[model samples]
Target: MDEAESAARRLAWGVHNAVGFVFTLFWTAGWISLALLVLLATRRRDVALRMAARCWAPGLTGGAGARLVVEGADAVDWSRPYLLVSNHQSVIDICALFQAVPVPLHFLLKQEMAKVPFVGWYARACGMLFIERDNPRAGPRLRREAAALLGAGHTLCLFPEGTRSRTGVVAPFKGGGFQSAIDAGVDVLPVAIDGAGDVLPPEGFRVRAGVITVRFGAPLATGDASGAAGRQALADAAHASVLALLRRSA
Candidate 1:
């Protein structure tokens, strides 16, 4: 491309990012406010999840000009609860999953997130499970809490990588979430999210308009698998499934 064309494209990219950032702020503040009201009025987490699915997810994703496409959504049985595991790439991954997945999913977030200004309040109000990683007793407590939530027929979405990948590759899966699934006796649903890294790079605030694909893989049953060996097997299987989906999406 010529210099003029290249410069024009760069200018357009900057403008789009600027506008998207502003929209994201407003979207977050508005939904958080609504979430607070819902918590005060009804105090039901299901209602908050429905509101997020119908209003926040769609608006936030669409306003950022990010198109969300879900593959293998039919593989999910809405009637049954699942432990949804996915690869972590960027913050946009959360938005993409929330927009594409046709379910009221709850996240297993870090306890530190519970201290964030608006996000923490919203997460707490929605009854998301938070893990205090620094606390010595947090591991067992988290597993028990997660099991209880799953047993209560709530679907939990966890990033088995534990943190976002800076290299845009699927990292090794953690054993905690898989162990929770085993303890809860639920199906582990592997999900692969592609293209979110390009939309918003790690630790960067600028937004880029693009498409993100969320692919749900076949569920791996943790039947009678409560031991460490079983958890490792489940983790490996989930990691492989997510890697395959990422390759296919690419």
Candidate 2:
């Protein structure tokens, strides 16, 4: 088989197994599994995140293929709290992000997603914060919660573009997430994910397997920079870093 056909088959097989596992967990494990996840979340957030990943590990392996690679992660201080910003692609981006950063991550998600069945429950239990896209109070609430999370020494992962791009191109970055960093007083780590859009294109449920690389750029310097200059700097750095990674991969 050629590259494309091999990729499609691998992707389908992986996703199929993953759905089966989720169903098994729902029936066999039942509430016990959900309880265990909650207990784990309370006792050890890192382990909880790891377990979350394990629940879909088979699909993750198949979806990413052997070409999935991570680069430049050693430079991060896993013990300390830092803002992780990345380019948004497909739903697969969540799994890739979690695996790339082996730390307890709190994602800034949309309020609408909080209504999903298992996923919504998991996100809430994991202490993931969600913002109402159209709510005027959203900004203030996000800043407040972000400050609290950072104060409590928890790391956050947010997509600066706010939403997934319809096209493969990285969308323009918004400054609000960076503003949260200023409020929380932490450095922002820019992450770039290559080929996720192609792997699971946004257009449909069909999957195409290939190399999905997660690249980490050096932490964007926040230092004394704040307000517009700082936000712009962070946004520019994130876009440039991801774009550069894509170019390198190509």
TM-score for predicted model 1 compared with the true structure: 0.91
The residue pairs in collision within model 2 are none
lDDT of 1: 0.85
Can you give the TM-score per candidate against the true fold? 0.91, 0.82
Best-matching candidate per lDDT: 1
| Highest TM-score scorer | 1
For residues 1-250, what per-residue lDDT tens digits would candidate 2 score against the true structure?
A: 9999999989877786576446534642444365456656587555666665554533454644525688989877788888888898877788787777777678999998789766677677778889887888778877898878876888898998888878878888887777777777788888888778877666655455577789988877666767788778777877787788667777
RMSD of every prediction? 2.1, 4.7
Q: What is the C-alpha lDDT of each candidate?
A: 0.85, 0.74
Off by over 4 Å in 1: 1-15
Q: Please give the lDDT score at residue 60 for candidate 2.
A: 56
Per-residue error for 21 in candidate 1, Å, reads 2.3
